[model samples]
Each structure stands twice: as C-alpha cells, then as structure tokens.
Target: MEEKCTTLGKLELEAQNWFVKVIVAEKTPIRFLRWRRQQRLVFVDKENERMQSIIYEQDVDQLDKLLELYKTYHVGNAKIREITGNTPILGTSKHQMILSRSTYIKRTEEHERIPIDHIYQFTPFSELPEIADVPTKQINLLFSVIHVFPPRFVERTKRNLQDFVIINEERRALILTLWEEFLQSEAPYLTKNVHTMPILISFALKF
Candidate 1:
C-alpha cells in the first residue's frame, strides 16, 4: 500500500497506483504533462516559469481507475515544479530538493570491465564548451574513429563496431560511438587504424 497524497489535498491511493500525473493548475497558464515509466518520467511545461503539479506511483493494473479517482477528487501533493526545459525538479521535504539532470552517460560492458584501447587525438569541436554548459539532462555526441582490438578477440557486427569503445586514462582518450550519419558523413576524421585503442566509455557516479 503506497501512500498517494495530492497537493490539493492529503489523500492516499492504495488500491490503484496512477503514475502519470497531468496538472492543469488553477491561475497558471502553463501546460504541464507528466508521465512515469521504467523509473523515468517526462515532465513538460511549455511556459518559461515554475509550474505546479502532482504525481504518485505504485503497482496496480487499474491505473486509469486511480487516475479517474484523482481527477474526480483530489489525491497526492501538488507543486511538481518544472522551472526549465531539460531540467526537472520536485519538492519533497519542506527544505530539500531533487534535481533531474540529463547528461551524456555510457554504460559499462562485460569486456569494458577490464582495460581496452581507443583512439586518442580527435578533432575537438569549437562549440563543445558552450554545448556542455547548457542545462540539459541529455546531449547528443559522437566519436570519429576509435582504435580497437583485432576481430580475433572482440566480437563486432556491422554498426555495432561503431558502438564499441575502449576507455584508457589520460594516456589515450575515449571516443564514444557516433551515429551512422556522423560516421559516414565525417568518415575521413575517424579512419580505422590498427594502432587505435579498444575500450568502453562509462560514467563515474558524481557525488
């Protein structure tokens, strides 16, 4: 039984757990459409200001039933704030806050657990600093060419090869897999070479 309280009122949603919360708040002209799934939710507020909303989640089949109950009456707490685009925040305690930052993240693979190799020198983008500064949870980036292990030990397929990497320390650099278009259009920049390193790119959790 998960506690479901509404901002308009303090009510519990025990039977039905409606994860998607769409808030059309009173006195505000912003549109906030929110939905939660797979531990990820899409919160959108077209207006450029702090918007208010409500949301709750649990396990149930009759999500619509719970949602209708919420619309008819008032449940969970209100005040789901969407202050800016790409950056979402929600109020939990009286004084605490939660920040949802979308960033470029790479996952570790079984082979990546050990050291691999990758190409080092790259054609640095002039606008990289500015693009990195923008407050965004997700950014699109690509790698030119990465030196990798011979096909003997590593398994790679047509497009999957572009998806591979080897993260060496400062000794060499990590170049992530760029999309096929970037790889094809900018083919000359990342030419395949036997000397390049083969490794994976991963994120060291930030505190």
Candidate 2:
C-alpha cells in the first residue's frame, strides 16, 4: 500500500501561480524562458543539454532557503548543506558534496560555485587503476606559429580554427573549426587567457 503522506499547510500564493523551489546544482543558461504550462515539463532548451531536473509543486519556504544561499555565498567555498530543503542533502565524505547528475541539469540562471584552481584531471579515477594494461605510445608533437597575415580586413572562412599558437611543451594544441555563421571578432572572445586551460580546444556546437 502507498503511504499517505501529509500535505504541507496552506502556503500564501497568488491564484494561477504554482510555486516550486529547488536547489540548482549548476548555473542556468543566460537565455532561458519557460511558459506556465511548459514549466510542468523539465527540459526547456534541448540545445543546452540540461534536460534533467526534479519538477514538482515545492514549498515556498524551501525556495526562500535556496534564494538565501544563492545570495549569501560566492563562487568558491560556499556551503549548501545548511539549507533545509537541499536535495541529496548530505555529503558522501567530509570533503565532497554529492549532488546527483540529474540535479546538475535544468539550470534556469547563471549561478554556479567554481573551484579555487578550477583545474582537475578529467579522468575517472583519482589514483591509478589496477585493471587494464595500457599500451605506451611515443607521440611526437610538432610545434610552429602561423602568424596572422593582415590583422585588419580579416575575412576568415573558418573560426578560431584559422588561428594557431604553436608551443613546444611536448604538448599538441587542439585544432578548432569555426562555422560560417560565426564571425572573426567573436573568435578572440571565445578563447580566454586562463590560468588553467583545457587541452582539447574546439568549436562549441549549440545543437
């Protein structure tokens, strides 16, 4: 038999308003919109790849807690557990907060807690795995700098793919291809001077 759970007490809400409050794991996209009926469904923007989220008639008190945490904390070193209605509430270990993968999607705004260094190995294991025997390969990285010919009046058929900053740290720079709709001005803006940069630099396809 399904247990009959007690419904929460009367919440002060305007008519035609369905209030829901959820703790967001990642920052929502800048361009986000949701109609009243569509709000019943989780995925708003399929291109963003943020289709997973828990959607239900949530308590307003829980929403208040979420707003408080969002405003109080900065990007790094923010505490979310103290909030009353935080889903997947407890941390697995003392150092890690285990918010489920689905909660991470369905972001409605741009607000996320970034790590200090913002640099971490993308591999699955923190330490070396004991299972598979991996073959070794001596990859020779070729380094060269192709200068920008005629900086002004630049008619780039491709995007950042046309530009190259070849360096020899025995590392190969990722070759990115740009789309026709993309402009050259936007190219410089896409790639930033980051202290911790990703090796696999490539064109971001919205679709």
Candidate 3:
C-alpha cells in the first residue's frame, strides 16, 4: 500500500504520523478571542519552509522546556512527532490553517559550534558564484563594514524602516539592507564604529 501524505492543515483530525526535518525558528505569545493565552512556536523545514504550531496555557511546562533547549543548544535540526489534542483551531484566517497542536521533538543531529575564524572556510563571500551562475538560491558571506547609511522610512503597504550598510571583505564590497528590527538594533552600533570594527556576515538565505 502507498503511504499517505500529511499536510499542516490535516494533522489533528487524521490519526496519522508525519515526519519532517525541522529547525526551531521562533516562539511568541499570541492572543485568541476572549482568552489572552497560548504560545506559538515557529519551525522551518530542512528546505526553509515555515509553519507555526500552537501551545496552550496548560502546556506552559512544555514551552519552558523547549525554550530552555532553544537557549542552551540553539535547537538545530530535529525530528518532531505530533501529539494530537482536542485543541480548537484558533480562527478561520489563513494563519490559523498552518497552526498545529503540541509536538514532541528529538534532536536528530548534534549542534556543532564553528569557530569564528573558520566561518569563511565553510562559506566564503569571495567564492560565491553569481546568482545566475549558481543552481542554488542561497549564498553565505563574511564581510567587514565599510560604511553605514542613515535609516530611512520606506512606505510599503505600511511605513517600514530600513538601513543600508556597505560591507566588504578583501575581494569585494556589497551593500546589506537591514529591515525594521535589525535596523533599529544593530545599525546604531555598526554605524558608530564603521571604519574601525570588523563585522562578519553569514546568512543561509540570499540577501
């Protein structure tokens, strides 16, 4: 018999096992109707696909454990098993469709901490092939800050803040754009010592 495929929407109602290679993305508090409770933990698949899972007020202990693991070990790739519960779906919105009940996670791989000096050996900015020249959509880089421009207000669907910083290694210089949160936090520090400090940039996705 052929095995069935499980999607985010159908996990709870169907008594089936779904296996996925996931990395913990984030955990945030959420409000639901009159009940100002429940936490949402976000996960990204091996391919960088995102999904949000729900944890109720009663599951605060589980949340605490997960948070501790996240802080200490920096929750890397893991195998997660869903624990079906009678939790009601939060809303009829598109976001609600991606929410799932509690899960039991087991780390499949050990987290390896790479030394800061050795980062370039893994993914050097100099060796990055042009986007059109490469098959994959992602590239990693390590760069030093050359200059940082003032933060600017961009009018999107709503007003959004952005900052542009010029960074370079020995071979090339590139501009990195920081969105709202990163712009506010890191930009100030980076701008202050743009000429003196050495900044390393490594990203899993294409910027």
Candidate 4:
C-alpha cells in the first residue's frame, strides 16, 4: 500500500506516524547546547503551511546531510508534539515535528505543489509601535538596508553582534541587531552593499 501524504496543517499530536511531502524552506546551523547539539528546519507543505522541526544531537549530522534549503522531501515516521513553554513557535501550526535516526526522510524531486520560497507575512513599519507592545508575537518585516555598522565582539557574552539601520517604503527607520552566527554568514554581504540600499526581508523578528 502507498503512504498517503498529509499537509502540515492537518498534522495532529494523536497521530503517531505522519507522512508529509514538503519543501525544506529554511535550515539553521547546528547550535551547541551545554549537553547536546541541535538544529532546526522549517518545512512548507503544499498548502504553503509551514512547521518547525528539530533534529537533536544524535540525528543532527545525518539529517543535516540529507536536508537542503528549497528542496522537496518525503518525510514519515517523525514524531509530532505540541510546542510548549517560551519557545517561539513558527508558522500557523502549533505542533512541531521531531526527527530522529529512525525517522524516514528522503529527498525527492521538486514539484509545483510545495513553494520553494520562504513564507512570511510582513507587517508594516507604521504598525510596529502596537506590535512592539506585544512581546510574545513574532513578526516579519520588509526593509531596505541604509547602514551597516562594524561587527563587535562581546567578551562578556562571547558573541559577535552587528547593527544595521533599515527603513521601509515610508522612510521610517529602525535599528536591527544581528547576533553570533548571523554576523559571520550574513553581515559581510550586507555590509558590502549597505550603500546600495539592498532590499531585505527579515522573518520572525521579535521586540
């Protein structure tokens, strides 16, 4: 019998096995925690619904090798659970997927069903004042880079921090901060073209 594919929005905690054919929308670098290494991948279903998934220390390497940005995959045998506590949940779905060594993940050919681009619901700069008052919610912003400051190494936190001045179509400006890994990977490019006014779309930004 063939496995039936399910959309991210249809996933429920009660289901032990989930079969999803989705595009790998976003992938993060492995984060080193005190006890374990972890990585996150955001998958987008045919409906354009996204869900965040975690690969713990054990499965990080294996899955990282298999998953790539904007690629389509058939996923199954992954555990689904409700997100709890302070962790900022991504997408419309409240539940998250957990992948392990036993999880079935196979990269498949790209199809028109799933979107290759990352999904973001951008909030206007004029509305930021109200949204800033609500700290619990994460929002997306679209802006142009007006300035990029030199990266600073913080001895106390052992992290690199960089700042960028951005503005929206209304010319309203705001300061954006980039921390740690983003400095090494994203800062240089933004800094190089800061004067050219590059358009930037930031996802999941919180006050």
User: What are the RMSD figures for all models against the true structure?
Assistant: 18.6, 15.5, 10.1, 2.9
Query: What are the lDDT scores of the predictions, listed in order?
Result: 0.27, 0.25, 0.46, 0.81
| Model 2, span 38-154: residue lDDT tens | 111111111121112222233222322343222212111111222233222111111221122223222234443322122111221211133123222112232333322222233
Q: Comparing candidate 2 with candidate 3, which one achieves the higher lDDT?
A: 3
Identify the leading candidate in terms of TM-score: 4
TM-score of each: 0.21, 0.23, 0.42, 0.82
> What clash count does candidate 2 reach?
1
lDDT of 3 by residue, 1-207 (tens): 012223333334333355444444445434453474666554443333444556556665555465432321222122333433544222211232122224534444345321223212235555655562553343556577777777677765455554445455455666677666466556777777877856655444344
Better of 2 and 4 by TM-score: 4
By lDDT, the candidates rank as 4, 3, 1, 2
In candidate 1, position 203 carries an lDDT of 21
Off by over 4 Å in 4: 1-3, 116-118, 153-160
Between candidates 1 and 2, which one is better according to lDDT? 1
TM-score (C-alpha, index-matched) for candidate 1: 0.21
**77-196 per-residue lDDT for model 1 (tens digits):** 222333455433321211111112211112223332212112112222344455554433223222323453222212453442244343333343444444433344423333454245
Candidate 2: residue pairs that collide: 28-109
lDDT of 2: 0.25
